[model samples]
Target: MKHLFSVLCISAGSILSLSAQQTQKPILYGRNWMAITGKPLAATAGAMTFQKGGNAVDAACAMLAATCTMWDTLSWGGETQALIYNPKTKKVIAINAMGVAPTGATIEFFKSKGYNFPPEYGPLAATTPGTPGGLIYMLVNYGKLSLKQVLEPAMKMAAGYPIEAQAANSIEKGKEHINQWPYSKKVFLTHPGEKREAPEAGEIFVQKDLLATLTKMVEAESKALKQGKTRKEALMAAYDRFYKGDIAKEFVRGAQEQGGLITMKDLANWKPLQEEPLQVNYKGIDVFKLQQWTQGPVMLQALNILENFDLKGMGYNSPKYIHTLYQAMNLSFADRDFYYGDPTTMPKGPIQGLLSKDYAKERAKLIQYDKNNTNIGPGNPYPFEGKTNPYLNLLQQRGYEMDTTKRNFAPKHDLGKINTSSDDVYQERLLLGTTSIEAADKEGWVVSVTPSGGWLPACIAGETGIGMSQRMQSFVLDSALNPFNVLAPGKRPRVTLSPSMALKDGKPFLASAVQGGDTQDQNLLQFFLNVTEFGMNVQQATEAANINTNQLWLSLGGTKTEDRMPKPGQILLNNNTPSATREALQEMGYILSFGARTSGPINAIYFDWKHGSLWGGSSNHGEDYGIGW
Candidate 1:
């Protein structure tokens, strides 16, 4: 452990060194392909698939499966959103596998229960599980591997594996909550009723129920294949068993038996969708993200606004650059809070207008070069789309109006001023995370996925070791808060899990993703700029100093008026930031806090089209890793 830490310091220094040096975890270089994710073993799962002659999609599915089993801040019941670059069609396609509010999830129901929003924990917080079906969907449609084959590494680990300190400590931290659910107690607690109930670091943690669950799915696939079903058909059979067969029965029975809203029909009704992703041209690169149902558009929106400026000329992380970036993000998130939501349902926001370059230009004009704009609200995009804004009155009721007269949301000197303890809870929710998967092969297939939900202290359904997603907390109960995003039965919440991909000269350029809720896009936006504007290599960009804004409404956790409220003018800066830059930001009406590692721990694959090689980057912030061959 001591040696690893020493090497890590060197790795971190290697990236920051002006002179050419080796990174702590060096950039992955491969002529054929590369795979990267949140855990070393999980990346190896993708590598195993690649070695088995799998395409990027197949390798990605394998990586997601491994991460879920290993609890890389997510699990099987979580949601998955992916952007795949199909070399054949030369088009980017989106996979939206986010689960919806289950039956009895109406706002009135929650309000009657004396809740501000959905409960933050337990069965009540769950949506239907989506990852299982999502994994099957991606494999059947875009992959050339069988469900049984893809799940091999995950199944092996599910049986038993030496648990890492991070996951073990998470179980320890969340043990109080885990104790609430009997099944979770059985799976996560290796020494229940002891001083430290959760497994110790490096303990061989085992989950027989989860292993059985995985075996059942593989069994279903095997049976279907033996009965003369095709590979895709067999995969669907496994999906059916999970959502409609015995597994579904047990999951529903277990959840409802414990207080969840999911019904068997809800499970059966939910299915993954394939759609066109949202895209914006930054200079000449075409960047793509999941559509309006997610916070993804926020990144594209910010990019459009930044496109109007000569970002390169401002210099990197300069006072002027940071100020412009912060303001643009606030502007984008203002629209996200008011307008972005489940576009598949009634009263969709002006998505067409929101993404319009002209609309972005109009919004960009609102930025003040000298100071931060704490009072910025959603801009009018109706004119650009040629449609009258239907809910103009609704827009006025934004629940996050700045109250400078009240305590400062982010006081400089006394950073621990308002909402002290509650601030930590709010930050956790705002940054409730997900694990990312990035895979690419020489065959031109590339996959970027951000899979989340069902982290530790997660409620496990009976008999099945699967964790239920707490994604229901992302919903808004009041239409006035966000008409398009207000909680309703069968409606998907606007999610924070976003994966990114970019194409240059009509070919894949970069595939990147990270696991910080609101900060996902913030970090990604800067990473893109680090490469495009500052000319940092992919590895440097992944480890680059970046800032985060708490100016957006919280997407996860909390249940009161103040809980989801915005923290205007509050920004998190890296501790290593120049004191001058910090002072410059504070003068611009910004309250600054600091962290050693600020980026998303972003993992990415940059297509070195020039050299005909693939360059991989896994950030130094966390345990994220990458492998290439």
Candidate 2:
């Protein structure tokens, strides 16, 4: 009887494992791709478009439109940086819709206002919004479906849709912010006398104004078409409705009343800056990225640095793996702070010399296996700078260096000084001890991004709930010498948004971006390492144990990380991390602090031409969902 019971138990275990495997369902379709976002409805919308015979670009358009109404963190009012891989042309094109400083913005004007860069320099700090322009560009250049058709899903959702877990959470958390703006509050809040009546987990919230805005856009497009205007011309007319017509006027009035500096000219004169995407060749794969304004180069530098070592040998999620990745991130961030900026405005090559292949190789040589305290600034590899290919360097070179100089890793100051109290040496030792790290598997797609402009106080005031751009908050106020980065008009703030893409066998595979302030790169790096090096599926890759070492300390989250998280410094390890690995890290003199770290939600679409599939992944930490059919 005992023997029979043991056999039955083993059989049951086998059946359970098989069930788990089967539950890991695959989204399959012909002439159909799959996409996953943080929102199920949004994913369904994209899938519906795919089912309607729209290609990737069309699906992208439809999904984005829906997201504008469905997700508050993303909207038509925001900006976008995208990379579209067109197999037909055998080329990858990038679109940077990142806004620019208004024409009237100037350092001198800001100085005269008796304000240093305070993270909220009013309208003078607001850049010309480029999202609408960028979408228009995508529709004009890449979209096959008419603008009307592409916007249908978003319009439908905007008209009315049930709020799901993600949307409800956003509403609940952003209550203060939503209530602050009359229009915003109207769209999100339940009704009069119901200040806290947020939608339940599966209730409904409607954005009537957004729906109305969409209606106006559709009408504007119709009017333009009747006048025999081109599609681009029609879109431009719609843009004017928001920027030059009543919307623009209202926004301007609000800014003026609120002591903000936005003007009608700022909106009317706004244009998307056309530039080339930066590219790098890593291990026979061509990686492409947006320029400095988004911090895309740092990833290229880090990957290049990693290429020098055999990461596979280090073992997945081991102390060695985490150590190497953190070191690479720290080094790349150092370069990001010091030399990265709008290249066009800077001399022909500010850090062009630093991002070269030779420089990356040289930087990679500095990775010490055992030593901690190994800090090096960026190196200028002048001779290896590549040709400028649609790359727009959008940072002010004069003040750019100042921001970099004051960065926490700039040799003198201790990163721990700002937040964690552990000494630098102690932190390094602690890092060496923590283990059980796993890399995301490279399923069918890859994402690389460099989203920038987070310098001072997150400016968000006036103009239909428009807040000041987060770029203004990049500075730390009381610096005795070289005290800049205080939110100032015309002063472009520091940014960490890096536009990114991955390639396999010299072909473009994935293009993506995320919105974490500083942790974007860390997230992307981990994902990239997981997929390409560790070989995990997309979901597992995204869900794997991940640690974010933004500066000196590390925070864990995700499938693997979350389990052991909430474990404080010196807390017991109740995780699958190998005892050997933990011992190794502890031996390195590290103190473990288990908690959640924010690495803004990541977004990307992958093209697996060989398999005739395209896959996309969105951030688990965000309200966005991944949908692909």
Candidate 3:
């Protein structure tokens, strides 16, 4: 494996000045290809694929597979979402690899069981695994390599890889849950019996069960090829082995034993959707994301609202700038909470109205420049369609009342004197257990993907080494009022796994993604603005201080009584942000919480139009790494 600091340094006489390196965040520069991922090993896997003549899609799949093994918070059985930009077609494709509820899942099912909402963990929360199917789909349709070839690296890592400190910490946090399930304990703990604990960082952690499972699929593919099946046919056979063959049987048996609802039919019928990407034009640059099912559209709506402001004049991370950004996010998130859902169940209004420039102009008027507004709510988007949201009253009734005083905003990290002892002043660093990868080849093909689920608190299938996803928890149980995200069989719960792509002058310009659940789109928007509006390179943009609003509806299941509103005058800022700016914001009536960390580790690759080279950047805040050659 390649070292994290290893880079193919370009010669001194390049378009970019070498002197600037000392001042700016380090960025990996390469003439042919680049891969930025959540882990150095994963990036190295992708780079190896690229070196072996694979395209960007192939490299991305390889990297994602390796990431699933190395990142304890991610699993092969989790959900995967991606956006692929093919320069040859001048188009971007959205891959909705998120899983849906089983046929047995329904509001009444949970109601009869005396549950208000779906469980946050265990087999009951599991949806059909989509990552495997999604990976196979990408490989068969767009990749230049076989499934066996791409999965080899992942199998090797799963057998025994050097554990990192973060992964060990995550394992420790979920130790109790893993201990309850024998399969999970066997795979994640240093010992399955008493004295079990998270392995030490740099210790060789072996996942023999996971390796056996992956090897089985590879063998299945090889058997199909030996039987005279075509490459695509062999790939499909291997995919079926996970969803419709022995793996599916094991999942069904485990769920049945554990009182869960998933069945073989659900797995057999599941298929990842390939759809047109939702897009909005910003300053002549086209930004694309997944559909309304995700919080992706919130970023677009916020961008539309922000376009009306001269953000550059406000200064980056300045009080006014941050305020404006948060306000836009608040409005968009308000709308998202009230309306965003699966396309099949979305309200009557066309989604286009939400993205329209005209609607953005109207919504922009809600921004109050002189003071912060805490009582902001979703606008009348239906008015544009000559209708009203009939369920608005029910939404308001169910909404958690805004109580800023009760909201918590303390730093989770113990940053010496900056840390506070007050419970309300402290906040937990939210880890959603997700990973992202970006790959770009010399051919101009770019791929960005976010894979999640089956992390800590996940239920491992019986002897399969597959951790089931808890994505079903994203759905609301209200059958009457929660029309969009209401629990239903065959319905995909609204998710936060958003991957993004951007184009400039009809050419591929950017591919980026982050792993911060509800904060994914919010942080991604900041990165985009840092580059487009502030003229920062990939590295500088990634390393910049980021802010997240708690005012939006919580995506994960948590205490129902907690206030779901953004604390009035309260925003989170990393300690790296200037103290002067923090004081200014505090004086402006904005409560500030300082932490030593950013919202997420955003991995991205930028296509330098002038230089015709790829510049890649990854966050140093986490295990992220960037490699190019």
Please write out the lDDT profile of model 2 over residues 1-629, one tens digit for every residue.
Answer: 34322321222222222113221233222234654443567666666766676666666666656655555444555555666565656565666666655544555555565544432323444565555666667667766566677788888887678866655665666676556555444555674466445676656565565666667767887899899998878877877787788767766775556455667887786666656777777677687777665567778888888888777656556566666676676677656654454454432334576666677776676555543333344443444665442222222221122233353333343223332343443332222110000001122222222222211112233334333343333332223211222223333334455556767775666555655545566666776776677655444444445665534212111112112111122321225555555555455433444433233355555556687666555545555455544
Which stretches of candidate 3 lie above 4 Å from their native place?
1-25, 112-114, 192-196, 345-350, 385-388, 395-431, 479-482, 559-568, 576-580
Q: Write model 3 residue lDDT over 472-578, tens digit each, in one string.
A: 87887764324578888888888888888999999988889997767888889999998898777888777777897665556765423132223444577887765
lDDT of 2 at 451: 22
TM-score quality measure for candidate 3 = 0.89
Clashes of 3: 3
How much RMSD separates candidate 2 from the native structure?
Answer: 9.8
**Model 3 deviation from the true structure expressed as Cα RMSD, one decimal place:** 7.9
TM-score of each model, in listed order: 0.94, 0.76, 0.89
Cα lDDT listed for each candidate: 0.86, 0.52, 0.77
Best by TM-score: 1
Which one is best on lDDT? 1
- Winner by lDDT between candidate 3 and candidate 2: 3
lDDT of 1: 0.86
Q: Model 1 compared with the native: what TM-score? A: 0.94
Deviation of model 3 at 257, angstroms = 1.8
CA shift of 303, model 2, Å:
0.8
TM-score of 2: 0.76
Q: What's the CA RMSD for each of the models?
A: 6.2, 9.8, 7.9
